[model samples]
Target: MRQWETAYEKWKNDEGLDAHLKQELDAMHDQPEALEDAFYRDLAFGTGGMRGVLGPGTNRMNIYTIRKAVNGLAHYLKNHCVNVNDRGVAVSYDSRHMSKEFAVETAKVLGAHGVKAYVFNTLHPTPLLSFAVRYLGAAAGVMITASHNPPEYNGFKVYNEDGGQVTPDEAAAITEAIQKTEDELSVPYLEQEEIEAKELLTWGGQEVDNAYLEQLESITKLDADEQEQTKDLQIVFTPLHGTACDLVQRGLDNLHFHQVDVVEEQAVPDPEFSTVDSPNPEEHQAFTMAMELGKQTNADILIGTDPDADRLGAAVKNDTGDYAVLTGNQLGALMLDYILRHTDPKLLPNARMIKTIVTSELGRRIADSYGVQTMDTLTGFKYIGEKIRQFDATGEAFIFGYEESYGYLISDVVRDKDAVQSAIFACEMAYYWKKQGKTLYDALQSLYETYGYYVEDMISLKLTGKQGSEKIARIMQAARTESFTDIGGVDVLAVEDYWTSERMVAGSSQPEEIDLPQENVVKFLLKDDCWICLRPSGTEPKLKCYVSVRGDSEEDSRKRLTKLKTAMDHFLHRTQS
Candidate 1:
């Protein structure tokens, strides 16, 4: 029998497997493709952690896989964490199917090994989880969420003591330990009663919220009177049936934004996310209910948070009296402009902003206008969080950080992308503009007028399952082997191959070394000030291509982007889907 067949047989016959899971396995026994997809390989625990569809297989996220992943963390903690028992792991979950169960399972796995676990009593956002790690002084942390993925997906994320995702080295060490683990069915876990009796598991969240909210005082730029000035700034917020409802609402109330309205249908935690096709706020469809509420209330702005409440999306009324969804890049630039314009000059001396390499350069230009510096890291918020830690020691303050995927962090209080904080700051920005008789749309257009037209678009191609992974690998390898001279009639000024840590210029025989972690990403800088980047998604089964272009007019930029995307599609073996 093949390895997959043997693995399938073992799972099917194991009486230790849960009956429901066994039934699921048995149901797929006759479907060879389904069985192979589920058993071909272990679910990848990447630089962050494991994310996959929820089911009962080695490649799926189930009790066994959750325990196995946590077991790996336990092993790493046992070897590396000082005072592991006294400073244990903190765990929090979001509103996803089995999110709470996976969180408890992680705690139980740690508890069985005599490592204490502080688990959340209820669902919470990713930012709160990051804060709890430092607040509790835990050795590490785990958040049970898939961020903005669909409801069918859930994940486990590991964080270091500094509340940042584990570094590449840490993830590699944990992955090694995970491979050493065997007999998934035999992994032991303590029950909740036993966990409580032994003081192995405790509940958190409310206290963390208090501490986080207290810290929010220093980050929000506008004061109460300033907020009250734009009382006409009607705001509509929807958590998309996730975790941000209570906390975000409370924070806005504290600021006395009396005109705020929450989408009644999406305020409650619904694991199914029944109100929207997908809970991801990045998609326009996710804003349907929120937009309706916005129209009814004559709201000036609408905000939507994803399932884990880490990514936020918004729509602002345009000159035509219709609302237009602001792209992630647009939002980032707007926030950067607002922050730099209003921040104290004393604070501006060391204020720095961070963004991913794929993010728009408009933010960098805006920062340059203010004489502040900007830094770019690889595609994860964890790397941005790492910079926060470095900033803390070097006397540089984190003014803001954002990714092109609708994730933003306005402060270092939380070491990850924070929709709650973003929502609050975005509200203030809207109100600040409202008092000026302008909308965010007006503010964005004024920015384009000041800075040249800088527009960007991201295209993601979903190629799922085993074959999908192999295909993605092939595409990256092919790009590595071939050298490109230009794209869209623009000369390639330089090329950055992150996988090899090389920066290749046309005349330089020897490539310069990049001061960033080696990863499977390719970037090209064009002579026309346009750039395109290619990389595989770290958390999802998709190949992402990002393009940015600056032109004299919006129409000119759109034309250039169209030609550029065609060139990318041809070069990357993908079409605009």
Candidate 2:
């Protein structure tokens, strides 16, 4: 029998299988493809914790897989954490299907190991979990969420004591511990009654929320009167049937911004996410209801948060009097510009902003104008969060951190993307611009005028199942070996292979070393201040291609973007063929 077949057989005969999962297994008995897919391999725990389609096999996300992952985490914590039983772990969940179940399961596994767990009583944003880890002085934290993935998907993310996602070294240690557990089926968990009797579980509620919101409020750069003056700035917000409805509205109200409207159709917590195809705010389709509401209210801005409320997206009225959703890069630049302008000049010397390599150069330009140094990290926000912790230890300043995927961090209080804080700050930015008799669109244009006109875009090709994974590997390998001197009529100035940690300049015979963690990524630097980057996504089954260009005008920039995108699409897809 094949490896997957043997794994399937083992699972099929297990009497302790979950009833729902058992039924699913029974249904797959005659379906060879389904069986193989489910049992092909254990669900991968990569940049994000293990996430997969919910089903019956080891490779799927069921109670058993959740138990195994938590079991491994418990063992790793026991080894690394001193007095871990008292330090405990913070647990929180979003509104995804089985999210609450996963959170409970995490606590049970911890309880069995005599480790305490401070779990939120209700669904909360991912950033709050980050905050709770530090506020409670826990050894670690787990947030049960899949962020912006589709409704059928759900996963958990691990955070270290510093309230950021676990570092790469930590993840490897945890993975090693997990591999030592030979039998996931028999991993133990404490009963709810036993956990309660042992004082292993404590519920977090309004008090934690108050503490988080209090810190989140500090992200507002404006003073009291300026905050109050934002009342006239009409705003529309939609949580997209996720967790941000109550807290975001309350936060805005606390800022004295009364002209805010919530999209009633999407304000409630929904697991199915019935209103939208996918809950990711990065897509314009996710903002449909909010846009309609903006039109009805003639609102100045539209803001949205995904299921976990860690990523935020915003749209402002353009010159055409229509809502134009700002790309993550554009919004980040706008926010950075506004913050730097208002920042104390004395702090500017010590301040530093961070962004991913794939993010727009406009941010670097804006930071340069303010004398704030900029740092680039790998794609994951964990790297950015790790830097924040390092800066804190070294007594350096971290002003902001963002990525191209609609993720931003303002105050270091919450180490993750922090959509809740970003939403409030975005509103304040719009209000600030409005007070000057300008729209956010105008502010964006002014930024372009000051900086060069930059156009940035991303293309993601979804590849699913085992074959898809293999094909993605082939594409990445092809990129490393393929030779190219020009693309889209632009001469290639350089090539950066992060996997090799080398930069091969056009004329230099020797490759220069890059001082960053090794990852499977490559970048092509073209003439005319244009570039293209390629990498496989850490959280999902997609190969992402990022293209950026700066030109003399908007039209010129867009034309260059189109040509580059066309070239890249052909180059990436031809590998599979």
Candidate 3:
């Protein structure tokens, strides 16, 4: 019998397993495909930590796997951190199935290792988790969420004492320790009562929340009157049935925004996320309820946050009396402009911003217009957060950081992308524009007219299971060997292979070194400053193609994007053939 099949047999017969899990295992006994997929391999941490379908398998996220992962983390913390009993870990969960349970399970595992655990009293947003790490003076942190993934999935993200996501070295060390945590099923999860009695566990809520809320005032540049006047800007807020409803509503209300209306259906947390096709705010349909509420209130803007409230999506009323969904790039650029308007970089000479390499260059352009320097990191908010720590000194200041996927951070109070902060600032931006006799759409148009119309789009091709993985690898290999002169008849200015950390200048044999970490990514810079980037998504089973273009007008930019997408589609598909 195969390794997985043998493992399945053991699971079916093990009396140590929970009856509920045993029943689930028995039902899948006849389904070889299901069993194989579940036990073929353990779900390892990716850019967003270990995320997979929740069920009774090594590959799935369940109490056992959670215990194993926590065991590894406990060992890692012990090896690297001192004073573990004092400066321990801060833990929190989102509104997902088993989220609360996982939080307790993690705390129990830590307690077994003699580490202190400060867990939230209830479900909370991701940013709060980040802040709690710093607020509690923890040596590390663990957040239980699959940020924006479907309800069937749950994940775990670890943070170091700096409140940033674990660095590559940290992840590797923890992974190694986890590999040493043999017999994952035996990893003990102590009872909560015993754990608390031992002083290894404590519940944290109101204190951390009030402190987090108080930090919001630090990110806002507006004074008392300015905040009060923002009440005139009619806006609709939706948490998408996740965790942001309370925090965002309070942020807006505290800012004295009188017209803020939250979508009632989405205000409460729901593990099922029954409102839309998915809880991700990046998808236009996720904003459906918020838009409905916007129309009902005749609101000037609409904002929605994903399940964990780490990602945000916003729509602004256009000239046609309809709400137009703003791309993540558009919103980022707008936020940059609005932020700089309030932040005087002249006095803060070391002020700078950070963004991902695949994000729009329009942000760089906007920052340059104000004499603020912008830095680029590889994809993932962790890199940006890392930069924040590196540059967070007396001289160097972090103005703001954002990703093209609707993640933004105005302050390092939380060392991750914060939708709560973004939503607050976005609302203030809309209101600031409204006070200027302009709509958010109008403000975006003005940005384009000034910086040249910059448009961006992404295409993700899904391929599932083992065969799909092999096919994807082959395509990436083809990209390595193949060369192209032009895409859509536009001459390729240069080609950058992030895997090699080398950039091949156009018409030149020599390659330039790139000062970024090596990853499976490639980019082509075109003659007219347009660009295309290709890479497999770190957190999903899909290959993503990102394209950005800057043209004189919106129509011209759209035409260029369409043509480039067509040619790129043909180009990539040919590789598989």
Alpha-carbon deviation at 26 in model 1, angstroms? 1.0
For model 1, how does the per-residue alpha-carbon lDDT over 302-351 read when each residue is reduced to its tens digit? 99999788999999999899889999999999999998988887778688
Candidate 1, superposed: residue stretches over 4 Å from native? 224-230, 574-577
| Candidate 1 Cα deviation (angstroms), residue 371 | 1.0
lDDT of 2 by residue, 87-109 (tens): 99999999999999999999999
Candidate 2 clash pair list: none
Every model's TM-score? 0.97, 0.99, 0.97
lDDT for every model?
A: 0.88, 0.90, 0.88
Better of 1 and 3 by lDDT: 1
Ranking by lDDT: 2, 1, 3
Error of 1 at 150 (Å): 1.8
What lDDT, from 0 to 1, does candidate 3 have? 0.88
Please give the distance, in angstroms, between residue 128's alpha carbon in candidate 2 and its true position after superposition: 0.5
